[model samples]
Target chain A: MQRLLYSLSGASGQHYSPHVWKIMMSLKHKGLDFELKPVSFGDISKIEDGSFTSVPVLNDQGTLLGDSFEIAEYLEETYQDAPSLFDGPGGLQLSHFVESYCKTVLHPTLAVIAVMDMYNIMSDADRAYFRPAREKRFGKSLEDVYAGRDAELSTLPEKLNPVRDLLTNQDWFGGEKAMHADYVLFGTLQWCKVCCPDPILAPSDPVNLWFERMLDLHDYMGRKAVSEAVAA
Target chain B: MQRLLYSLSGASGQHYSPHVWKIMMSLKHKGLDFELKPVSFGDISKIEDGSFTSVPVLNDQGTLLGDSFEIAEYLEETYQDAPSLFDGPGGLQLSHFVESYCKTVLHPTLAVIAVMDMYNIMSDADRAYFRPAREKRFGKSLEDVYAGRDAELSTLPEKLNPVRDLLTNQDWFGGEKAMHADYVLFGTLQWCKVCCPDPILAPSDPVNLWFERMLDLHDYMGRKAVSEAVAA
Candidate 1:
C-alpha cells in the first residue's frame, strides 16, 4: 500500500524531467509521502510491466497513473482534506491554459537551450536513447541543435514576455498563492535550471524573482534538486 | 442613472476597439444594461472631462473608470448577484494570463494584419489621428506596415497554438461555460472581425469554431456587431 512515483533520473540520480517535477511538486503540495523510484530513459519501459511509456507514472497503492495533469486532478480528488492544488474548478480549468502556454511558447526554445546539458547529465544508456530520439524530433543531430543554443537562449526573455507581464502585478500565477498554474511554469523553468549551466532568466527579471520565491516554497523543494544552477 | 460605456467608433458608427468589446461582453455577462456611446479616436479625450485617454471608459452612474480589467472587477464587485464574470479568484487571476497572451502573442500580428482595414474603416478625423499615431508606434508608414501584413498573417496560426491546444479539451476557456478569459480572446478576434476583410483564422480551425460559438453567446451579442466577416 505504498505510494510510489516513477521518475526519469539522470546521472547520479538527478530528477530533471519537467513533467516529473510537476508531479513531484504536486505530491509535496498535497503533503503526501511517497517513494521516488528513479528510472533512466532506457529503463522507462521496464517500469510497471512496460505499460507506461513516460516518466512521472505514479503507482498509488495498487492503482497506476501517468500524465501530470491527470495525476494532479487525481490527487486533488483523492486527497480532499489536503491543500487544494487548484483552489476550485475555475483555477483547475485555467491551469490548462497555463500548460498550453508553457508547451507552445516556452518548450521549443528551452528544449534547444537545455538539450546539451540534459544529454551530458544522462547515464550512457539514457544518453544513447535520448540523443537519437531528440535528434529525430528536431530533425537535427544533437550537436547541431546545441550549436544553435545561443540563438535560442537570446529568445528566452521574449518567449517569457507574458509571464514577465503577469508578474508585475501579481506575486504568483495563483493570485495570492502558488497553485497548479505556478507549478506548471515552475517545472518548465526548473527543467532548464536543473540541466543548463547558463541560467535561462536574468536575475533581475521579475519572472526570475518569482522563480526564486517558488524555489523557497514547500521547504525549498525545487532548490534541493541537483541543478547546474546550484552547482554554478 | 444610466450606465454608459464610451467606445471608439469607426466610419459607420462601428465600435471596434478590442478593449471596449471586453467591457461590452462583460456588461452583458453580468446582465447589466449599459448604453454604448460611440466616440472616434479624436473624441476619446472629450469623454469624462478629458481625464482618460482610452476607450472602454465606463461611467457607472457617474463613477468614472478606465481600463477594461479594472472595469470588469468593479462590475463583478458591484453586481454580485449577477452571473460571475470569473467563477472565483482563481479564474479572475488566470484571466490576466489570457489577457497577457492576447496582448503579447495575438496583438502584434493582429495589429499589423488589420492595419489597412482599420484605416479604411475609420472616419476622416480618426484616420488623421490614427495614421501618424500607429506609424509612430510601429515605426513605419501605414503602407509599409500593410506590405508586411501577409507575413504577419502567416504567423497567426502559430501564435494561436496555445488557444487551439486549450480548445481541444474544453468548449470554452471557462471549462463549462464562457468566462472573462473567453471574452478576453473574443475581444481580440472580434476586433479583427469588425475591421479586417481577411479572416485571420482558417474556417475549419477549432479556434474559429469556438469563436463561432462565442458569437452565438448571450443571444448573439457578438454577431450583432458590424463585422467584415458577416459582410463577406
Candidate 2:
C-alpha cells in the first residue's frame, strides 16, 4: 500500500485552491488509503531548488505528483474503485467547459479582482504600491477589474449551458454519478466565490443544489487524512 | 483505430503550445494514426466563448477534449500503443515538473509577458500603447524581465537537474529511454521559443541544441502545419 501525502496551503483568504477540499472528499468517498499534509504556500526554502519543486504536491514514497488536473486524473484512474472525472462524451465535454472557466473566466476576471490589496485588506500605502502598480501592467483600472465582468457574465450561458444541461440530465456533470467534473466545478466555483462576487450569470439553481449534496461527502473527508479545520 | 483529430491555430510564432506539440510528436513517434487539422485562431467562433477550444482540440468521433494538459494526458492513457507520458514513478515526476513549468514559470512569466500582444496581432495602438503596458505588469520592465529571469533560469537546473543528471545515469528525462518527459520539455521549451525570444531563461545554447534535435523527429509536428503560411 502506497502512503500518500497531499501538500497544500490556505491562509487568510489569499488561497483560492478548492482543489484540496475536493480531493479530500474524493479520497474519503472512495475509501482510498493515503496521507495528507497541508503545505504552506511559498516555502521555497524547503525546495531543493535543483528540482524547483513546489506544493499542492502529492508524494508517494519519494515520487512526487502535483498540478491539480494531473493529480486528479491520476488518482481517479489509478484507483479502480473510485469515481472518475472523465467517463465518456458528456464528461469530456463538461471538462472542456470547466477548463475555460478556470483559465479564461476565473483566473483573469475573478483572481485579478479579489486579491488582498484589490480588496480592503491592504493598507492604503500597500494598495497604492503593489495594487496600482500591477493594475497598470495588466492593462486595466481598479474599476475596470470588475467593470466589464458583467458583460463577460452574459456570455457564460452559451458556454456553460452544456454543463448546466448536464446538471439536470445527470446527477453530476458527467451524466451518471458525481465524478471529477463535480470536483473541478466545485473547485473553480469555490475559487470564483473567493475571488469575485458570485455572478448571476445563468440560472444556476441546479448547480447550487448539487453543491449542497456534495457536502454530505465532505464529512467523509473528516474521516480521512485531511481533516484539519477545513477551508473556512 | 480511433481517429484523433488535432486542430491547431494557423499561426505559429506566439500561440504555439508545447503540450500540443508533445502529443503530436508522441503520436507520430509511435506511428499512431491521427488526422491533423489547422484551425484558424478565431475565424470561426466556437460554441464555447473561448478560442482555445477552437484550437488544437482532439475529437474521437464527436467526443471533444480541450486544454493541452488534459488533452495530452488523455492521449497518454487512451492509446497505450502511443508513446506513454506517464510510465511509472520517474515518468510521473517529470510530468509534475512539466505541469509546474506551465503554471509557475511558463504561464505567468513567458506567456503573459512575451506573448501578450502576440495573442492578437497588434494594431498600431496595441503595438505602441498596449505592448509596453502589459510588459510592466510582470513586475519588471523588458530589461528587468531579462535580469529577473536569470534567477529563475538558475532554478531550472534544480527542477531539471534530477533528469539532466539522469542522462549520465541513463537516457532521456525519465531514465532508461525517452519518455513523455522529453516531449513535455520539448513542447514547453518550444512554447518558450515561439512566445518569448529568450529560451531557458536566456539565450541558452543548450536549449537551442536540444530544440534542433527535437525538431528532427519527423512527426514531431506535421511539416505542413508549420509551412510558410502558418509559420508567419
Q: Candidate 2 — which residues are off by over 4 angstroms?
A: A1-10, A13-15, A18-22, A33-41, A44-55, A83-102, A112-137, A141-158, A194-204, A220-232, B1-232
Q: lDDT for each of the candidates? A: 0.88, 0.50
The superposed Cα distance between candidate 1 and the true structure at residue B96, in angstroms, equals 0.7
Winning candidate number (TM-score): 1
Residues B102-195, candidate 1: write the lDDT tens digits.
9987898899998999899888998999999999999989999999998999989988889999999999999989888899999999999888
Candidate 2 chain B: 10-residue stretch with minimal lDDT: B161-170
TM-score of 1: 0.94
